[model samples]
Every structure is written in C-alpha cells, then in structure tokens.
Target: MVVSLKEAKLYLRIDSDEEDTLITSFILTAEEICEEILRFPLSEFEEVPKLVKQALLYCIANMYEKREGSYYYMKNEGGGMAETIGIMKIILGNLRKESW
Candidate 1:
C-alpha cells in the first residue's frame, strides 16, 4: 500500500487504536534515531546540512513536541539528535519510494 505524506497526515488525525499505535511508532522511532545522532561525539565533524536534516526529521516526526503550531520539546527518550533525524529521513524516503 503506497501512502502519500498527505494520506499519512490524514491518517495521523484518526483516533483508531491501531492507527494511533502505528502513528506513535512512526514518530517515536524517528525521534529515537534523531536523538541517537545528536548524542554522537563525532557529529560535529559531519556536514551541517546533514545535522540540519537530522534536526528537521526529528522535528517533523515528533507531533507532540509541536503544540499550537510550534515544536516545543522532545519526548525525552530515544537516540540522540542525529540518529533520530537520519531514521526519520530514511523512513520518509522509503515511504516516498514506495509511492513510485
């Protein structure tokens, strides 16, 4: 099943138990991976764009961090920033690929 981001966004708002779990897992796992990346001691040595990408992914995957239209905080558990971001982007990329 190819799910567009728009479709995923719609699914995100549904309150079904199964959909809730799936959405939570998607966001949480991405956040975890981003957290992992940010924790790395060598992260500074990498490209700034890569770091930004990680940060962005972390931000996007975290729906709860956002409140009233702005991101507020991370869930406080998971991988560092980099890992979370990387994982999110990877997931998003994969999801995009699935549409093709």
Candidate 2:
C-alpha cells in the first residue's frame, strides 16, 4: 500500500511477524511488487511531497521483512533485507527530488 516512510516504518513496528508475512506474501517477484503498489490502499499520507511507493515496493519484494524492534545484532537469513533498505533510501531520495 502507498504510505509515507514514517507510516511504513510504523507499520513495520506493529507485529513484525505478521507484517513481514504480509510483505512476503505481497511480493513474489519484483514485477509483482510493483503491481501490488499500484493496488496499494491510498492514504492521506500519500499526499506528502516526497513519497515513492515504488521504491518501497521494490525493497519489500527483494528481502524478507525483519523482525520488528530488533536491537541487538542478529543474522538475517534473508540477506536481501539490506538491498530493500537501499531501495527505500533511493525511493525516498527520488521522492524528495520530485518535491523539490
């Protein structure tokens, strides 16, 4: 779903296990992820100046969602999590550029 970075982060924090499952289920492939974003439930937050749902979708498609609120270092079996974060950064950056 299209959401602000803050909203997405908050959603991730709520029941990481469940959210991860949702993210995993939503993304079977990169293309699927993009398609899913197009289907995202729109929100008022989407009106924000800088928000790239596509970037978030790409990241989610690539990696297994992390356990919410993890503090200590732990091994992420799905190594693609980092890639996802990178994608988010890029998406957010692109959004910022658009707003400018």
Candidate 3:
C-alpha cells in the first residue's frame, strides 16, 4: 500500500496498539479508493509516485479523524466529510491525468 501502518500511526499521532488494525484497514481502503480513482491498480507501477503516496496519506488521515462520521453522500449532503471526499476524488483525478 502507499502508506505503512507505522507511517500511518505516526501521521495520526496514535501510539496505542488498539487501533493498529483499524488504521491498517484505513490504509488499505484509502489505497483501494486511490486505485479506483486512478483507473488502475497501484501494483502496475514499477515505483509508486510520491503524489499518490501523499494522496493516500491524506485519505487515511481524513478517515482516522472522522471515524464516527456518516458515510452518506447524497445530493443534499452538507458536511465537511462529504466535501472532503469530493476533494480527494479531485486530487486523484488530477493524478490520473499524469498517470495516463
């Protein structure tokens, strides 16, 4: 994945081992989302790009901060989480341009 468990924990300032598994899941989920937005598997690249790594870190951090937030993204949705997800998409979309 783009971000390691250790890196993620450090990034998130989480020192406890209790959330290690959760953080790992978030890392994986962020990588999957990045791949989806990039239109290809990250494994296809010989070396993953720095921008992609940064994007994944941002995605993982977002999820960690809003662990209890809702995942509903409706037309009338009006919250920072929804908009934050949209911004993540935009960031990956730009990466898609350079990747393709």
Candidate 4:
C-alpha cells in the first residue's frame, strides 16, 4: 500500500491501535477510489509523486471522518463534495494520460 497504516494513523490523528482495522480499511478504500479515478493501478507506478500520496491521505481521512454519516457535505464552503473532487482533479491532472 502506498499509504502506510502509520501514515494513515497520523493523518487521522489516531493514537491507539483500537481502530487500526477500521483505519486500514479506509486506506484501502481510498487507494481503490484513487486508482479508479486515475484509471490506472497505483502499483503500476514505481515512484508515485508526493501529491498523489497526499491525495490518498486526504481521501482516507475524509472517508474515516465521515463513516458515521449517511450523507456528507462541506457546509462552510457551500460547495459540498465538489471542493474535494476538484482538489483530487488538480492533484491528478498532470499525471493523466490522453488516448488518441
């Protein structure tokens, strides 16, 4: 996994192993989502960029934080999930490949 359990824990501000399993699940889910969005497997890249890793962290944190909720929204920004999606787009934009 590109985002280590330790990293995920730190990002999630988790200090105990109580939720290790749950955090690992979130990390896996985030990685899958990122790979789907990028249209490529993360394992295919030997040297993933820092931004890509950060994006994964953000995704994992978001998922972990919102697990209890039936629905999610960013009320402060008035953009809901668009802000997150936009950030992901910007992070992956340069790495996107065009098919002719």
Candidates in order have lDDT scores of 0.43, 0.44, 0.78, 0.77
The number of clashing residue pairs in each candidate reads 18, 0, 0, 0
Top candidate when judged by lDDT against the true structure: 3
* lDDT of prediction 2: 0.44
What are the RMSD figures for all models against the true structure? 13.2, 10.9, 3.7, 2.7
Q: Write the per-residue lDDT of candidate 2 for residues 25-87, one digit (tens) a residue.
A: 544343344333334323334363335545654455344344352543245444355556555
Q: What order do candidates take by lDDT, descending?
A: 3, 4, 2, 1
| Candidate with maximal TM-score | 4
| Pairs of residues clashing in candidate 4 | none
Which regions in candidate 2 have their CA more than 4 angstroms from the true location?
1-21, 24-51, 64-79, 94-100
lDDT of 4 by residue, 1-100 (tens): 8999998898888899999999889888878777767878888898988988998988787777666644444443333345655777788888765621
- The regions of model 4 sitting more than 4 angstroms off are 70-83
Q: Can you tell me which runs of candidate 1 are displaced by over 4 Å?
A: 1-18, 40-100
Can you give the lDDT of residue 14 in candidate 4? Answer: 85
Q: How displaced is residue 1 in candidate 2, in Å?
A: 4.8
Q: Cα lDDT of model 3 overall?
A: 0.78
Q: Which 10-residue window in model 4 sums to the lowest lDDT?
A: 72-81
Question: Looking at candidate 1, what is the lDDT of residue 37?
Answer: 39
